[model samples]
Target: MTTHTDFRAFRIHNDAAGYRGGIETMNTAALSAGEVLVKVAYSSVNYKDALAGTGKGKILRQYPLNGGVDASGVVVASTDPKFKEGDPVLCTGSGLSETRDGGYGEYIRLPSTWTIPLPTGLSLRESMILGTAGFTAALALLRMQDNRQTPALGPIAVTGASGGVGMLAIDIFSRAGYAVHAISGKADHFDVLRNLGAVECIDRHQLVFSGKPMDSARFGGALDNVGGAMLAGLLPLIEPYGNVAICGNAGGIAFESTVMPFIIRGASLLGIASAGTARDLRDQVWQHLASDWKPAHLDRIATREVTLEQLPEVFGRMLAGDSFGRTVVRVGKV
Candidate 1:
């Protein structure tokens, strides 16, 4: 139904100095060549987006790239048999915002193989609200469950509990009848974590290691978004045969950890990589998020909605570790 060729986007450019993102008018055809073109309705900000936008991390290996890892919208055209004109689709990761154009734009052309029909029971906005962060959170839980993690075991600890992935993990574990202990550096957001179903909250500083090889068992399992000392400290305290899903590295990437936990406690470390997930697993996770694993307080979890022009400010807030919950960008109306 839309005929516009040039649309607005938040594009990042790399030059002799560094990377920078700003609003610009871009041609639909200028997007990377692909089988399907989508009119983006919504996208969400993640830690990676902030890294790409501000050059805080080495995420974008290419220059002049559109930088949003998650997007959901109605399909405009498709040359592939799997998708047709006017079909609603969602795409996240799969090299988006990295090797190809991404979702910070009003329009994005992506390979048909990378697109999935928006799962039933979730709107375009809702899908983006969950975004890559929420998807990773759900995937972590799913992996833990597959490894025999159960609600009856003991409390599940979620690190970086105020961040996007951490908050959703708290909600999912709580809804699944597990007691969740949220660990956060932002002590002020303790009440928010509690409202999101975290039964107890702990400060990040309290999770530092004390050079001990092992500690008293505390958590049955853990969804850890913070790496480094937090992760190292948590390993020795997990119950036997427990799983720890390692996702983010908001804390420093390096940490010294001993093998005592794995050898003695039988704790397994599960790595969650949303970027290279298999299509079958990605589809299954999305379905689960739309059905049984969907967070009940999505509106509350989404604390802010900003236009493309307001993204720089949001990125600043995120990098300062001041933003909480999800921030969705309104690209267009579905």
Candidate 2:
């Protein structure tokens, strides 16, 4: 590999008035001070990344910060005795792209605690394909399982089935022997969702309610990616003692609901915040995704690969809700 004093990155700048992000060249020394510096091979786009890249959300508190939440690559240098040069590693969440210069650049420097040895059986490219979204999905599934959710409890519902987390959740749940019901606004992608192991697909409109506080029980549990009414609608339908893993707030954050489900039915609503999870837990989830929980169709699920220069257009597509599955960003040939 060729080493250069400076490399390209997509950085976000914020001032007293505004925020903006675009491509720029940055020196390796410009990276945030950390114990390890990595030559990033691959990164993946997330909804948070799109929000940060376009200044749609206040995701980055620091100005002139490199922006990417997920990166997988080989270590180029390390002060931590546990890691050495050329070791493959991946980093996600743990305040990446928010408090530190993240993976959008060719090189990223981060504390050793933020890095995980790339799990065996997953290549750097495949690991980036799972990225933070897949990890969140896996964590959600594992949480539900720990809560005693099982395939014998009837069908499990997954909201936002067309997005990265939803798609992966569908694949994971289906493979785990549960009947999968995918909820999506994009009826056009019904076939694709089915191919990902959704036994059935429900249109988002079908879940909409007109002031009703409760609906007929339909699912044993749910993995909800879209919040708001979709989540509110889901609560009443969970079987007694069923679990709902709440992850994203893409649809909206607020929803009105009563406590009938939890109070009367004894249902559990589990919140999944992959970003701030303990490092050991994160490592365990990565191990699960690399082994027993690994999706069988990873290569088929990833929809596109683009270079760093192509990110702006991709970000625009994602913001418009026109993208699907995973979009891996190739920072350097790997």
Candidate 3:
């Protein structure tokens, strides 16, 4: 493999002015310390990446870092026993864009422990099509299943349904035989949501956001991405003993609600921190993403592809809530 000092990356830096990210030429030697050097073929944009790139949230623990949380590529070099040159692998939520440089570049040097060898059924591009967003969706669904959630319970509600996690959640749950009710503010994408397996697509305002703390349980379970009022509203409507996996807080972080949803209705609120998941569970989740939990419409979910130079506008669009589904970045030749 050719070792080039010249490569491009979308790097973020915080200075006296504030946080900013843009595409720039970089060298392989400038990558953060790790056990494997991957020639990143693809990376996907997630809400966290939007936050980090646009400085809308506290996603980056430090500044002057690359800013993508999901990447899939071929390893070019490795000092770890688990990986070798030419291995197709992927990494997500291993502190990328948080404590270390991430996958926004054509190359990423990652700890081998953070890498998962590409499962038999997925291609390098297919892996990034799923990316961290899809992985989080799968992880949330798996957690719900572990807590005894089943298709027989009732329809599953996915809030923020047009975004990456929500779209993939809708697809995976529907394929798993559950009726999926997608709730989104983007009315224009209702047909797209249905194409991805949403049995019903409800407008964000259609649901009652203000009412009694406890209501008749409407959904068997739910995957909540917009975590402020939307989540507060959904908690009281989950079936008894049903699970609601709390993933993203795209709406707002703080919310107020009574304990009746938990204590009276026997509802369960499960926190999903995809980045901090244990290695074993992470491995299990990725295995499922490569297999059964993989979305049937992976190509459809990856609705857009861009070069690294286009990331700033993409992140801006995400913060404005104008983007939908997944946007994969072609970082390098596969």
Give the whole-model CA lDDT for all candidates, comma-separated.
0.89, 0.88, 0.88
Judge candidate 3 at residue 94 and give its lDDT: 89
TM-score of 3: 0.96
Q: Which candidate is the best by lDDT?
A: 1
lDDT of 3: 0.88
Cα-based TM-score, every candidate = 0.96, 0.95, 0.96
Off by over 4 Å in 3: 1-4, 16-18
For residues 60-177, write the lDDT of model 2, one tens digit per residue. 8778899899999998888899998999999999888999998899899978998899999899999988999889999998888999998887899999999999988888787778
Clashes of each: 0, 0, 0
Candidate 2 runs further than 4 Å off: 1-4, 16-18, 208-214
Could you give the candidate ranking by lDDT, starting with the highest?
1, 3, 2
- Show where candidate 1 strays beyond 4 Å: 1-4, 16-18, 207-210
Q: Provide the lDDT at 170 for model 2.
A: 84
Report the lDDT tens digits of candidate 3 across residue range 150-258: 9988999999899899999998898788999999988999999999999999999766665678888899999999899888889888988889999988779998889
What's the true lDDT of residue 51 in model 1? 88
- Ten contiguous residues with the weakest lDDT in model 3: 1-10
